[model samples]
Target chain A: MAIQDIRNYTGQITQENPQIRIRLNEELHPRWAHCDMISRYLGHLTGTLDLEKLEKSEVAELGDSVNYVANELLENAIKERSGGSIEICSGAKGHTVTLVVSNRIEAAKSEKFKASLQKLFDGESSLEEKFFATMEHNEAHPEAKVSGLGFLTMMIHHGADLSWRFESGEPAHPGRVSVSARLTASVF
Target chain B: MNEGNHSTAGPETDPVVSGPEYLVRFSRATGTVTFGGTLRLNSYDEIKSMVRAAVEAIGPTGVLTLDVRQLKLLNSSGINLFAGVALSARSSGTKLRLMTSSEYSWQSKMLGTLRKLMPTIEGA
Candidate 1:
């Protein structure tokens, strides 16, 4: 069966002028379809293109990391937005790959998202501790599990840096949040 | 050449639903459990219970060789489950050795981290 296009937004992926860019409209594809495609494409490109400087294992790991990070951000964006579209953009400059996911959400949700960022910062010392803590917390209160493990995995496992923007709401709409992550490829 | 007793996991013998999600084979004679395919939340418990039982049956002196080279796509929760099994083996004085392939980097990265959970984890 064909995939259900729920979002109905246009998406584009371009690699021109020595840079790679992947832009997607949350309205175009399902939660993880876009991420899966981009990661697979990136993996293919790495295998067929100029990524010979990196080892075979590194290329595979990079693809998996990209897929996981993109999926995490996309899922968070969908949950944050009650009645708005999400825009996901990823670009590669040299060996650093950056991903940004943006959406509009309620003020309270924005506040909660920001608070989770602090927990990520605090747990930077031990990945295993953070993972188990998140698992246990999720086991106790399932609601708190949202985006917790995803953000932590991006930081601890993939060695990515995460930053966010929570813009206040306007007169008619809720606040807008944009979470970006910068991951330096561990190719060398 | 020589044999004690060997068992493989499948639809007939293994209780775990082994299909697209994951496949597990336990060898009682050799104390080896091999895992394959993706391990997700749905089939997590099946694999864990199988491993746990296999570890216990192997006894204290036997070495439990967990070969996860073909097992791909383990989510965070699945990794946590694996950590539990590895640590249980450690505490029970059952030697746990992990066999992994060099092709999949996620396995190496995650399994390497799991080593810290069980300091004596071999071939991680």
Candidate 2:
């Protein structure tokens, strides 16, 4: 699915009201490529995306952070379903942010997929784990065209927290495997 | 020779000027041209120009050794540029070898992938 179509799910409010909400819905398989594209698309759609709109150093930091988180989130989706679609609902309240990136995983792929997400989260909890994870590949998505680093970049470097829910029955609101994240500005 | 006939020499791999590598007259005798420097997104444009120039001068029958010892990082955009170089060599039937020390960032890993994607040259 296209990001534009996904936007219909969350009803975006990029215009700095009290929060920033972005919804991305897409299919599986291209795991890394989709995350990279959607991330960039949101980056463009939100033009100067951030509460403060960022300066030189801050913008650089933001880009790297988002890239990492993107990798983590994408890997989480691709571990299961070969052709399942994903929907990511992202929202930010002040310095705190939330992104829900979910995909349409089948019953057969649900368990393994959830396990992968949990594993990624446990690894991300520690600094060393996050560091190593960023450099390594997701064994699950072995045939992937690109190195899987989008989610790691976002979480490890960008201050985003990863979370997801895989529901196989009734496929939940048609077709979408949802994976989401919550990001907050760094304290320092 | 025929000034690079289409049936002969393929899509151009940019040429590497020698002045930057110490005025070593870049003639048909050079055989292979090696570059040493950064390969960030910004430097990719200059590198491409140099590569195409080198490939053109090196001709289809010759070989080019890309010394990546100095190339530390490459952004996604830079990766595409590098891929194009490899593709050009493949389509044109020229030989391109990339040599890098162990100190490559995650970006450089894309080089290995590019090499794998195209079986024409070598080293992925």
Candidate 3:
């Protein structure tokens, strides 16, 4: 099969040096509770950042944002994983905190994920409009499988920069995708 | 108001629903549904059902106030659940209000977005 790679970036530009990396094995069948635990841990770690300029309340807010972003990313990864390990990396530089999560998915799902993301990144609607539309859609159709609210919340509510990279055709790992979210320390 | 824990009862009886990390209790006397603790459920099914039941109990022409000041963390799924509840209340001509705290920025911001979506959903 031919190799395929797709990338999309949005929001502020920042370089990342992931200081912490964790991998969750699919064999263990991690539960949803694990996502909450990991996200809380990340939030605690974020709170400890030595950004002296940030006020105590600002630091707390940043930590909460990190926790929310991490939980959403990890939840999506775990829920959509296709028999491979999920990797999470988190770090901070200056006022920006970066979190990246990579997981293996079925090759076929990559297109669907990319399309959903395109709607988020390239659609003509403003983020707020798209968010409300998505919420209304979900409300009207309770049985819809995908809500598409996670990324929107990360961007609109938390003020996080979001990006994604999808690759396929590797011999050992056919479908691998990574999503990165960068958050500024300042409270929104 | 009826503060005791009650199962999914009819419109007259107060319902107190508990999840792994959260509890949602509706006080019929006050027309308020108080959500306390973190709510990061993997899927929206559980929270959706609980919220739907509570809203249904409110019935048409009734006021439904969501007191989320105590809710610490509500994931995107949970946010979506509230959005659905708000729309439902609007369609049924039920008055909806959200009570939030500034301490939890996410809660306030999420509720603010919902308020913007549905202008009738008052926020305090």
Best by TM-score: 3
Model 3's DockQ?
0.52
Please give, for residues A20-135, the per-residue lDDT of candidate 3 as tens digits: 77788877776577788899899999866545467778788889999999999998987777777888888777777888888887777777888877667685788988889898
Q: Please give the CA lDDT of all the candidate structures.
A: 0.62, 0.46, 0.79
**What is candidate 1's CAPRI-style docking category based on DockQ?**
incorrect
lDDT of 1 by residue, A1-188 (tens): 11111121122222232234455554564343344345445544543433435676666666677666766676566556745667666666556566677777776876676676666556456666877565555445534334256666677788877676666885467877767776666865
- State how far residue B74 of model 1 sits from its true place (Å): 2.8
Judge candidate 3 at residue B22 and give its lDDT. Answer: 72
Could you give the CAPRI-style class of model 2?
incorrect
Docking class of 3: medium
* lDDT minimum window of 10 residues, candidate 2 chain B: B1-10
Better of 1 and 2 by DockQ: 1
Would you list the rank order by lDDT, best first?
3, 1, 2
Candidate 1: residue A61 lDDT (0-100):
66
For residue A106, model 3's alpha carbon misses the true position, in angstroms, by: 1.5
Residue B100 accuracy (lDDT) in model 3: 91
Looking at model 1 chain B, which ten-residue stretch has the lowest summed lDDT? Answer: B1-10
For A1-188, candidate 2 gives per-residue lDDT tens digits of 32212211343322234233433334223543455456545433332444554455444444444444544555456554446455444444544445555555665566655464455556426643553433333223334444434444444335555544434455443334555555555545
Q: RMSD in angstroms, candidate 2?
A: 12.5
